[model samples]
Target: MDMWLHTANGQVNLRVSRQLYTVQSEYQTIEIFESPEYGRLLVLDGDVIFSRSDEFIYNEMVVHVPMAVHPHVKKVLIIGGGDGGVARELTAYADIEEIHIVEPDQVFVEACKTYFPETAQSFDDPRVQLIHRDGLRYLRGRQGEYDLIISDSTDPFGHTAGLFTKEFYGSCYRALREDGILVYQHGSPFFDEDETAFRSMHRKVYHSFPISRVYQAHIPTCPSGYWMFGFASKQYHPVTDCNPQRWQARNIKTWYYTTNLHRGAFMLPKYVEDLLKEAEAK
Candidate 1:
């Protein structure tokens, strides 16, 4: 039931256990297999995307920070997060009117719904509208549409390769409203040294927006236990004035994100800052 998985850098390893499960309602799929280490790590057509377990940290950060910063966020668009973890966090906000989840693979969504109920429950919420199609194609057909666009995609490989392209970033810029914010999960900062993809995306997004910044988070499953998120906004920066007393009133117990943590996350290390500066100069 247990298997060892090696990291890309060959410096880290994980022992995963296999389990069995099923999802009964809506796009149901029968029992297949589950990875006990990181919850359901699925290998479909040689592409990997998490199907279950505690990887919500990445999704939560990508979804919550932009929502929290833009208090008036009424509409949200999530690209490629068929697992619904981002959608789950979006439902937590009472002000959100509609959440559009655009995922290309119906099977991935179905598998998640069946085997990983917690990650899939957000799809059941009335506020969520699931769209089965290519995310870039969908974005190309829309304009000035969303209040916030969260690109909850897999690593920049295979079908997800388009997500990091400048064309896609351009479309995302057009898809957002005037005051909209775009937050995308830019892969792990550890293994990715050149950061060419992130820099290219940042340059494209900076063309139309006044604010473009990158932040990092530590996730156990991701490479180097560190990941980065890029935020682009037409009218807002990720850092905003927060009413500490009001946030305290919400009474929510957060594992990783907080008012203090939010500010701290933006403070980048000297190395990363230097890299970004070099990229900007080029």
Candidate 2:
């Protein structure tokens, strides 16, 4: 008899089989097959936070927002996205001349390509350059190089804790061009209990860029069923006049992202907003 491990939340059910097969997401039908040493592959409705198969949602938000806001985004850098999702999205724009992806874990990239072909296909594009190295080390070596820097990292845990540090943010500030934009996955505000750490992180980012804001989206696999993204820019504000022509041209249908939804997503709940304000005050 085959054994199965299952977890359910409402109508969603995630199942892992002893056959070493696992579904990565429900909406996209992403699956991975391997041993437990590679981490558990979870199938979510739209996208999984850290898994390779769920790269679409994450890569889209990380790349598109900064790319769209900037009139000319020629050089891009992605940190911690070994799955190549952000690299894939950055290549979508004709203006993006080059994209450099720095991911520390070569094993994750290899595993993704082997088990999650759909998500790994992004790496096949010629415009992307992959580097197997620590993001902090990579950023430290460059100064004012990239037009946009996107950090698609895991939660602030273990090897990734340094990615959330003020020192890292400062390095990012130095690594970006004069008018560059920096976007990072800041985890879910709903499940974030370390108010001090959150506040400090925001403050550190604010010190580096004149414009900084946090946006939200409901990602089922993440904690509290919501995820937050931080956006900061040296010279440009994030708000933009909706370009119907561009929107129509892309023809990208999304379950969560929309023209009107862009502005609406920035509006946090009253309580959440109040907490942010309080944090800023300290």
Candidate 3:
């Protein structure tokens, strides 16, 4: 049977090789599908979370961009990356002493471990500490603990709405060290709903961090094929301070992320630039 996945842009048709797994987590519905085009596909509450074919694009961009600029990152906090892709990327860096993942859904974690084992390989890594709790609450008592914080959350809606708030961004700000960096998924600007969300999120993030910027990634399975991520830092600038040679020296092999592409990703289209400008003015 052909399965239709509904996103903000429209619906995507997937030819399922098999229904690998399905679970109703405490938070939302989680399903994994195998498609010829996308390979193993994960859908959360009807939205395409990640697919094997282009998963590297979203995962690499979110992790490496900030890590590249801030090479001294040691302690890391990942908010809402239940699929384990972000944790996998973080574990690759030996300098990273500890990685803490705060995810609300245990079902999502188990499902990913069961079906996407390759992507979930990092779950077994000794450096990762998986916590089943609310990300916002987890940051309450934390002060100057982590060098980098990545909010790999679902879209800003329902239970996830609080993740994008000024208060949450403020918490993230407080949770980071003096030279800490934060990167989060901001959704696609091509869709009206996503753009509106981006505006509100961008504004809150702008007010929270001293240096904030929006970067783009092209994920074909996502709503508009044009996704956005926010980078907010306390001291290190993502671009000006970005040392491509320093990162390349690590010899970390990446399929999607490159130093040149990192610079180009921040070059937003005029409309996106104007949207960010409007958010800043408001």
Instruction: Write down the TM-score of every candidate.
Output: 0.86, 0.81, 0.96
| lDDT string, candidate 1, 17-121, tens digits | 753543333322334345555666644332234435546677668876776677588999999888788888888877789999999778778777877688789
Better of 1 and 3 by TM-score: 3
Ranking by TM-score: 3, 1, 2
Q: Highest TM-score, which number?
A: 3
Candidate 3: deviation at residue 24, Å?
A: 1.0
Best lDDT goes to which candidate? 3
lDDT of each: 0.74, 0.68, 0.89
Ranking by lDDT: 3, 1, 2
- For model 2 the local lDDT of residue 17 reads 41
Q: Candidate 2: how many backbone clashes?
A: 4
What value does the lDDT take at residue 80 in candidate 2? 79
As for candidate 3, its clashing pairs are none
Number of the candidate with higher lDDT, 2 or 3? 3
**Model 2 per-residue lDDT at 93:** 74
**Model 1 misplacement above 4 A:** 7-12, 19-53, 192-194, 241-248
